[model samples]
Target: MGKYEKKLKEMVFRLGYFTRNWRQIVHLALATEHFGVNNRTYSPDFSLFGKRGPGKFLGIPERIRMMRARAFMGFIPLKDAVRLFPGYAARHGYLKGEENSGD
Candidate 1:
């Protein structure tokens, strides 16, 4: 596996530990060159660059679960899926102010 893949796998495992759901980590198909959070660049596996709803992409369901897990772990407000929507949408090509209106 490549570096990012390894890192992502590691992060997923770490997230599993934190999120307690290693058996079901939804990985992003693409690798992010770099992502920023709080003005710091991070390589979050499922960056909120193209997120909108609960069924937009792969790992979204798992992300939702992890976000909820965050609440029990601590006050990680950023872990909320709604807050990550912008970045997730951006990654998946569903930029804010341009959401798809299909059914």
Candidate 2:
């Protein structure tokens, strides 16, 4: 891989997290006290296509697969999302506990 890709992966490794199974997902769903809501995880692999997709020359399914890879699910607290993304969750109105979030 190129140096930039290596560094990007490292940064993601440092800041990103993924849950291994449904139990954890459920825990995140039922355990959060903020608005009695389920917080979800943010996966980079799932968002690979958010900014741009593989060149249009590629087949549509391939592009879809690139976007729908099996690497983007887990539960991140909305609070963590606010911290990780910095104002994005609030602006997007995902903050069910806005008053509790102190944002």
Candidate 3:
């Protein structure tokens, strides 16, 4: 409805066309002010900031699935995944140096 919301919607749409890398998502979220920083923790409102309808609507799950598929198919290297999605990778125990161990 507002300028930032419109921008975020557009970004999410664009992201759906691409790889949906977490790094990109986080960056966009932060850039569009959809992400809030709280004592080293990030709060992202994916519902509003994520892709809309037609298929895998909420985007984040679909993006994660895509990432997993890419990793499984060797399209993405583990190190790259770690680099691109450190928070997700660490939370899922796919990488070391996780800030929060619990999911």
Q: Among these predicted structures, which one has the highest lDDT?
A: 3
What ranking of all candidate models by lDDT puts the best one first?
A: 3, 1, 2
User: How does candidate 3 fare on TM-score?
Assistant: 0.32
lDDT of 1 by residue, 1-103 (tens): 8968855765665455545422223222221223332223455454554354535566655656554554335444433432333345344454557543221
lDDT of each: 0.43, 0.39, 0.49
Model 2 C-alpha lDDT per residue in residues 41-63, reported as the tens digit of each score:
43323322222243433444554
**Alpha-carbon TM-score of each model against the true structure:** 0.24, 0.22, 0.32
15-66: candidate 3 lDDT, tens digit per residue: 5634544544453333323342221225565434333354334455656556
RMSD of each: 16.2, 15.5, 16.3
- Model 2 regions more than 4 Å off: 1-74, 95-103
Candidate 2, residue 46: Cα displacement in angstroms equals 14
Q: Per model, how many backbone clashes are there? A: 14, 2, 0
lDDT of 1 at 65: 54
RMSD of 2: 15.5
